[model samples]
Target: MSVDSDPDMFSSQTTVASNWSKDERSQKDTFNWAMEMMSHGQYLPLKSQASLNLEDLQYSTKMYYIRQARLACEIVCESIAPSQGIELLTQVYQSMKLKTAETKKKDAVTDTIISAYKKAEDYTTKVQILSLIVEKYSKSELLSFIEGLTIYKIDAARKYASTHGPGQYVTPPKITRLRLSKQKIHHFIEFISAPCYLQVVGFGSRHLKLSSGLTVKVPKVIRTMIASRLITAYNNYCKDNTILPPCRATQYKIIKACAASQLKSLHGLDNYISDGMESIDTLKKVVSNLGTKGLQTSKVSDLIQSLDTLKLHLKNEFRSHLSTESDCSQHCMHFALSEKGCEHTHSNICQPCDRMYQIRDEIQNVMTSNFSNIEIQEKEELEHDILVSTEKNLGLEGSFY
Candidate 1:
């Protein structure tokens, strides 16, 4: 009886194994057919059909499918940029995984494929692609996916090592103080270093506005001036070796104060003054250092003298030009006035009475010059004649008197 039961049990076990084998073969066949269709651009017919269980498909089938997709990508790439190929590779990688196992869990797998592709090139375009992925995908999923792809493809594997693999550049390397946290630091660098116009208010009570596309290397003199104001800011805010973080409205005030203080400290208070606005004075006081107080009086005096000289020269040139214009206009007006047909009337004048004033001024100046010289000559002759008469009277004594 025991021997008979054993044969029966063996038959049952064999039947179960046979059924499992059949299922496996069927999945493998389905995967093979899917891959062949993909190669021939014949996937349209199979897109919606759930004809096979991917989890049941043989591992060999999945590998061949991936290889075919990669080859197809390469063929397309030969005629275009590798980026186009990589994008296609990424899509195909996702589609294959979609057909295979857990759809939701494939994100990690797909991300890994993308990272592997990026590692293939250190090109700027590749780096840009990686940056986009980093922003779009979760960090852990991205790291894990790259790990898996690298296992079979050693170059990808090596590149993965460069980041997560051993002997890679340090994960979070030492950077400048400003770049302490990668994300925050990068943002700060972009913000502070961006080319934008600065609208400043408070230096010498003026709302000073200036646009700067200046780089890190500010001129020594300008740097010194700014440093002086920074020193004031440091003293006022009680910090050193750092500038105040910009905060919208407050930024303009702080910058203006700092700039004013620096200019006054390094050059002179008067040098930074603007007549245009009233806030600059308040800023100047805010940034002013008690210890480094007064502006250099002598320099201010010198600048004043230089300005005065320039003003005088400009005034003389202006007056001379006006005089020349007036004379020309006067001659033209006189000619017009003297004409018998001048009865056409001033109503026809284009530029108004300003031209009449100019003409009158020119005529007066000309008349004054000519009349003054003649009158002087006549007066001298009268004096000479009086002297001659006195001399004659003296010579003739009482008779002549």
Candidate 2:
């Protein structure tokens, strides 16, 4: 019989054909959905869970999932409404928290790795773990955490190097390189002060460039190092014949002497009169003893006696000057307060004493107008003179003794 005419046979064949077509269409849709999910990074969680055992999951794989989740959250926030995106992000954050908790459950292994990284003894393994942490965490947090770790590590390394001798327990080159790259130069500079810093500078002199451009402060211990370095450089220049320079050791002794002299001066005298007298005596002695060898001893003695007479005359003049200043101050106070017809006088209340009051007011006005400028000018002049004297002294030949 013809298929079109045979109703039962046609109905059975149509049912079989419809079932096969539906099955093929379902398979194609499933394949396409899986491909789409993979393209959007959505298939990793499912694939990881299904194909990998919990023990077989690598740290890199976990980090990949974390990164993808963060990126997906960001994309959703940007492309969709904020509220909906926030809700999705919260779920992603919860997932991250769970993953972190799972990782933390293996505390013994993780702690071992962290300890190794901190000791910096296993360079390759430490670097790997550090890379993983840097990749997984925010850079700001990573940097801050590393900074604190570095401080402890530096102190420990210093102690270890000191105890074992530098040759025996030197910091690993790789760790040093990494630390230098990560550390701020200023902090490193501050950490390395003299005596303690001598070895560091000796090793890293080429790497260090201390200049005005560096705003980092030098500590007191290192200030001596800076001074010594400057002195050594000047000495080298002197050796090259650029200028005459004093013996550095002798200069140091001179500085000590000057400090001692200043302390003595502070406590020994109310004024510098004794210092002036002592200087004059020293000058007279030097001049007398250092005179021409063949010259008459009598002439030298006469010169010294004349210097003594001059010194006595100067002391008398200074005393007289001080007495005059005291007398003038007393006389001025008396005149301003007790002169006849003075407005300041208790008995001169009549006639208002307008002229004297006016003169007094004028004097006050003049003093007020000129005093500050006069003091400023005097200070400036004194500073200029001191600076000139210093320059002249520096330009002179320096004594080694």
Candidate 3:
């Protein structure tokens, strides 16, 4: 007969059966009370009552109830008193069963970690949890967690800074710095020993200064100096390793390609040169006008001096190219004469040589003497025009007055 039909037999079964019955009833009562408290938003009282009943509960049952109470308290704390809820959860976590299901244990651990992370007031606790995670978790998991934490902290900081306004100084929480340092260390360890160490070093050194400027509250001058030093060090490393060393020919080719792309036709060379000269003329006129108006001349003087230097450079380049082209033509002519078996002495100039020499002389005259005289004359004429215009303007203004 079934136990239900045999009441006498059930009663005589054993103390173990009776004890099991009592324990089951107690667990049901505790679960019902906890649920009722949670429904009524009595989270603090529920936590206390749950802790009291934990001693009476079986290990498995105790863990399940603790999880439920922790979740309820978290919701309450988030809406009302976060610190109190977190404190309650911490207590429940302490009492959690270690022998629980793997998934449940992981969930409990995660919840605890999250609680630790949210405790900004206690940076030490957060740092401890972060270190523990890094030490225990797989690299991929650690990286994922760190990345999320970094993004969250940065976003929170930005929001706080914006709300506080510019004049108000906002410093990052200590926990954030600790996490970032840990993350950087982890990244360095992971990448620095790899085959692509050079690439890693190149990237890190380049961005380290930028990251510091954006994330840290350092002065602009200091940041710039730090960045310069880092770049210099990276360049030195590249030089030492002969990794992608600079080639002057490659640089020249790149520059030539860029220039060629911008230039539509070789015939526009003279036009471009003339445009540059006209720009200089306009600058001179502006300076003269500024002087006539009795404005600042220091800036104008600096500009005029720079322009003179630029003009000198242009003249030098033109002279060098003229000399090079003339020498090239002479060499070609000489080669042709030798190939023809005509042994012409240097003193005995051929027709081609004579014409080339005359052309070279003309170029030399233009580069060395004619250009300088023309520039002097133009400057004098410009000065005269400026004085005349200034006098005319003064006369007109005087007549109006």
Winning candidate number (TM-score): 2
- lDDT by residue (tens digit), candidate 3, 1-401: 68899888877777778787777766546755655565574443333344455688889778877776566667655556554767765665666633232223245676576566666466334444454344344444444544446644433434444565422444656662212354433432332222211111112222223434663322211111122222343345456457543333433332332211122232333344344444445545645554554435775575456545544333222212121112343333334333454343433333432342343233234334423544566546645644443343223222211
Give the true-structure RMSD of model 2.
25.7
- Deviation of model 3 at 126, angstroms: 29
Summed backbone clashes in each candidate are: 13, 0, 0
Worst-scoring 10-residue span by lDDT in model 3: 218-227
Tens digits of lDDT, candidate 2, 290-381 = 34423357656765665566454333322221211123322133343433543332332212112223322332343344344545664355
- Candidate 2 has an lDDT of 0.42
lDDT tens readout by residue for model 1, 1-401: 57576898879888999999777765546655655554465332222323467676678776655565556456554335544766765676788865654443556645674755656665433433444344334444555555443222443434544555332333456774332345533443333222111223233242334457543422222222233333233333323225444333343444443332222331232221122112222222222221133334553344334334433322122112221112333223333234443322232232322332332233234334433554566435534433443333223221101
In order, what lDDT does every prediction score? 0.39, 0.42, 0.42
Estimate TM-scores for all models: 0.15, 0.24, 0.21
- Report the number of backbone clashes for model 3: 0
The list of candidate 1 runs beyond 4 A from truth reads 1-163, 166-225, 232-401
